[model samples]
Target: RWRIGYAPESWDACLNWARARKIPEALLETAGLVVRTDDGRVYDRFRDRLMFSICDEQGRVVAFSGRILTADKEQAKYVNSPETPIFQKGKLLFALDKARRAIIEAKFAVVCEGQVDTIACHEAGLEHVVAPQGTALTEHHARILKRYADEVVLMFDADTAGQNAAMRSAEPLLAAGLVIRVATLPGEHDPDSFLKANGVEPLQEIITAAPGFFTFYLERLTKLHDARTDRGKLQIAQQIVEWIAKVPHAVLRASQLQQTAMKLGVPESALQQELRQYRQRDRTVATPAETTAPAEDPGHPAETLLLQLMLTDERVVPLVQQQLAADWLSTGTAAELMRKVLRLHAAAAWNGHTSLLGADASDEAHRLVTRLLEEKRPAPERIPAAAGDCLAALKRAALERQFQAIKLRLAQPGLSGNEVTALQQQILDLRRNLDHIPRLSVWRSAKP
Candidate 1:
């Protein structure tokens, strides 16, 4: 709400008033109220326009958005106040001062894509409406909404570009820990046009029917990728899991995992396992000095492949668990992850890794799960053999570790004669067991 007399719109008028009132030049310059021309003449920055006062949440006017009064090819359509001491475009949301209470009472906020859209929604009786000032929705906007609203519905234009914009806004909003929904109008209509054509009732209906953030993401990505083929389905699953990782709530993510599995026609267990990995990748930060690919851990292939087999066939889990001891799983990051998976499975909290919806998994565990999800699934016929081979490999590694420990113990001078003999015999037995174990070529046979 810009008041007409708050500031003079003409250069001469402002100059005359300032001189008559003895206003300081430095104060006027610092306020960004006037522009100095090429010839050293000062002029009013805003003139003959419909000015909209932009205020902070405390209801103090800090800047303005001014629309052109008359069409001019050389003139831009709109002009905004330059950044000043009190104004930063990214930090302000238009109409927040007026909409705060309404948003809190309603328990939701309506975020339109532009200032006109915000104005239209407000006049149409939707009071809890706000808009970003000529920029994409930022984390600041999301933070502002999070303060007064449980959810924020995006009511951008119903066009391809508008849909894209809404989608883009979703990540920051979710990252800010706010529940997001999308209100898509029919055809090419925007909030303003829809309200004009169908009035507030229909417009409200559209908002009421808006999909939740994850649901909107699934629908949007589904259209972009064909899920009829296995590869398409896998790709869609990866995208959905990645998006779900953006959701900060593990409970919410677990529920979305089921929905994603059903939507992509993949196993819920596989998705659950993959969700862990996706979350890990989302949390990963790379160093600026590193340019080459990250070094691959030698144990990852076997460990992940074993998890993949167990993910596809739950019956192998018990047998795999029996062969892997707590000390054996302490060998590598992958081994440690498998230990958690085995422990969860034993407690009935994990159903092929997908059922542990409530278990808070670490980022490293998630990264491992995601890698497994992307790998080729073992053929149904080969699962048994692959599981057996992986089991043997795990066992042999465990024995070899034990044998090394025994030899290290034998190196100490404090060891008794009987203790040294016992250690040597145990080492011999471990070596014999290692020789009898099968070579697990499970990776070669598990190709898609």
Candidate 2:
């Protein structure tokens, strides 16, 4: 049994919104819920957007998650009902309400990242598709998902942010002992666009051929840093090894390490040694010093960079905003602080003493934030002169960090011949690059 409610205006409004967005009416009717306003006025919930009616276990519309189509001066892009007697974001499994039985019977759930994608999957005959409500899959969502199926196939978007979200979601799912398979669509297409373009068979093929998450991550890293060059390859390899070290499953980790070694033309023994040395060195260096203040948390580098940029060149705030909002920054505490700073800046309430993340912020974070607010602003005329120096310092710090990390890995025992060769080549290449930087001065001096 399902309860339904709707304002007359909301019903027509929602129908039009769905039709305009190309959502089939069958989905709407099948969802079984309706939009309602307490006073019979047009409700804000589905205003000027595409409405995705969330169904219940009995295939009745339990709620709606709307996607805004146009930018309203005062409106959120997506909106949903408040926790009604029947609906709660944490409890409701978005599209899964309609697909639970199929999922249970089939023993797998195809989880996507958005309402539209889930609907698209359902339309394409993937009856066990589900998604979160304009958010990352939370633990509650994972638990609910687990109840219906033990296997989850993540069909998230094929973008960097999407991939990151999928990866983050994986940790919790894996912890719950669910078998997870990651499926990436081609050419930046998500399930919706991919299905529309090539039908569901291509998507099915990609799912069938889907690689393990680590494999996907390594491949993505290689693409990010062109592995054709020695420096690029070294960077890629280090990044891959760091990621692989985080895997808790020994068998899976070993298998992934072997595959990674093969891909990078290094030996498995060398990779293992590098990871061990890196971990040992990290532990050794991370300890506090006696009679001296502890070193800044290694995580604070980005915060320091943000503070330096904000204090020295306020003109670069926009660039800083863009950088801070990048997907890489999303995982770090420093990045969150930067976002708060930006928000405060936007609201014009950013006083010099206003704390970010409250008074309990780490000493390093507090200092970085305070400096950002109180430090003297650099003049536009001085910015160019300062930019070069600042950039050089930043690059030097980055390289030093990389060098130390590599050295630590290199110090470990049990490197294979190929691993040793790869490492030697990387070290030599880095030295060569460093050496070439000085030669630029010789060319400049000769020209004069």
lDDT per prediction? 0.74, 0.62
User: What lDDT does candidate 1 reach at residue 232?
Assistant: 80
Q: Runs in model 1 with CA error above 4 Å?
A: 1-21, 37-41, 71-74, 282-448
Worst 10 residues of 1 by lDDT: 322-331
Candidate 1 lDDT, tens digit per residue, 5-77?
2344565665566778898755655456667777978777776667778887666887877777676878876
* Per-prediction TM-score: 0.59, 0.49
lDDT of 1: 0.74
lDDT of 2: 0.62
Assess candidate 1 and give its TM-score to the true structure: 0.59
lDDT of 2 by residue, 146-210 (tens): 54566788888888888888887876666555667889887799899999999988887887777
CA shift of 304, model 2, Å: 51
TM-score of 2: 0.49
Q: How many residue pairs clash in each candidate?
A: 4, 3
Predicted structure with the largest TM-score when compared to the true one: 1
